[model samples]
Target: MVIRVRDLVKRYGNLTALDHLDLDVQAGEIFGLLGPNGSGKTTAIHCILSLLTFEQGTIDVFDCEMTPDAYELKQNIGVVMQNVAVFDELTVYDNIDYFCGLYISDKAKRKQLVQEAIDLVALNDFVKFYPKKLSGGLLRRLNIACGIAHQPRLIIMDEPTVAVDPQSRNNILEGIKKLNQAGATILYTSHYMEEVEQICSRIMILDKGRVIRTGTKEELKATISLGEKITIEVENLPSHILENIKTNPHIATFDYDDHVLVARFIRGENGLVDLLELMNSSHLQLGRVYSELPTLNDVFLELTGKELRD
Candidate 1:
């Protein structure tokens, strides 16, 4: 296991940030940690990194106990947090060099590693530019380079792509895959569901500091009561047809409004064929039809209430 936590508990006065949470992340996988704001995702990460003291439970990394003074263990771990951390006075190359220098002493080796980091993040053109002169996307790339320049075995990225442009987001995602392919275990946390769905090998969804579900995307979707959703545009949907759809056993829920009809099917039920047959038999005019499979967002919303979290 790359990371293991058992019965972890964290409290802030009367509020419990983490309530006996247990988690495991395997090697050579992009493990996605997803949760709403204040859902203990950041707290759990802080505890695992030994940056915060927990009231109860243990944290282990690479099969060894994690501690604030575990310098050797810390050396093998790289962290890229949501906020960018770099020197305003230092240029791009200098910032990366400084972070890498913390783990490497050999001047020649550190130089090579810094260049590789720059190349990895495509920061060669901006190497001489100070952070104040770089765009938000370029600055984020620099932050990632600084964190991974030493090439640690484990990388923990918390919202690395936050507030970046689409091009920059794509670049960062591609870089993450490359780093994983080069033998780095990644612990990724993001609010963007599509990013997690795109890159995560396995995912764990948390709510109110508790693990709601953990599995592959397919497995998680399978556990939900939702299946495919079909939407059709129909002019003046008949009252009887609407009543028939509402009473259909295969349809878990449905809504008809403004000349459009949307039906959500129960898992393991194929309502599309049946619904189309009904529409054809009724000779109802159909404008457009769309079928969409259940997505990670749907699973998340279903398992965790749709209420907005702070």
Candidate 2:
């Protein structure tokens, strides 16, 4: 395993941040850690990285004991936190080169690594620009470049895509894939469920300092009662058509309002075909139709109730 966290515990005085949380991240896998606001995800990561002194627990990284003083182990880890950590005074190239230099001492090798980092984030055009001059998306790219410039064996990224434009988000996601392909294990944390589903090889959802669920996207979805959710826009939904829904065992429930018919279905045969056939026989005009499978958000919502967080 790349990271093995066993019976981890952390506390802020009496308030427990992590409750004996146990986690395992396999080597070379893009592992995703997901949670709502204040869910101990960050606390767990800090504990793993030896940045925070936890109340109890042991974290093993790359088969070695991990601690704040484990410089050799620390040298192989790269971290890009939620907030950008690059220096405002340094230009883009210097920011990346400086971070990379922390691990690499040779000047010739550091220059090549810095250029590779710039190309990895596609920040070649902004090499001389200070961080303040770059757009939010470009700044985020620079943050990533600085972290990964050392070419560490393991990388931890927290909300790297947050607040960026769609194009930059795609670029970051693609770059993450390429990094994994190049033989680096990644620990990814994000509030964006779609991005997690897109890149994470395996996922663990944390809540209130404990793991609520852990599995692949399909496996997690299978644990829930939800299945496909279908929506059809109809000019006039026949009265009997709504009534006949009770007879269809495949369909779990439905709602009709504003000329839109939304149906949630149990896992079974195609509900769309059945709905269309029934509506056609009823002589109802279907304006538009959309069918969607259960998503990571559905799995997340099912496990964690829809309640506002601080």
Q: What is the C-alpha lDDT of each candidate?
A: 0.91, 0.88
How many pairs of residues in model 2 come into backbone collision?
Answer: 0
180-267 per-residue lDDT for model 1 (tens digits):
9999999998867789889999998887888889999899899989899999999988888988998898999999888999999998
Compare the candidates by TM-score and give the number of the best one: 2
lDDT of 2 by residue, 155-195 (tens): 99988988999999999999999999999999998867888
Question: What is model 2's C-alpha RMSD?
Answer: 1.6
Model 2 clash pairs?
A: none
Q: At residue 223, what lDDT does model 1 achieve?
A: 90
For candidate 1, give the lDDT: 0.91
Lowest summed lDDT across 10 adjacent residues in model 2 is found at 301-310
**Model 2 ranges off by over 4 Å:** 307-310
The alpha-carbon lDDT assigned to residue 245 of candidate 1 equals 94
User: Each candidate: how many clashes?
Assistant: 0, 0
Native-vs-model 2 lDDT? 0.88
> Which ranges in model 1 have alpha carbons more than 4 Å from their true place?
307-310
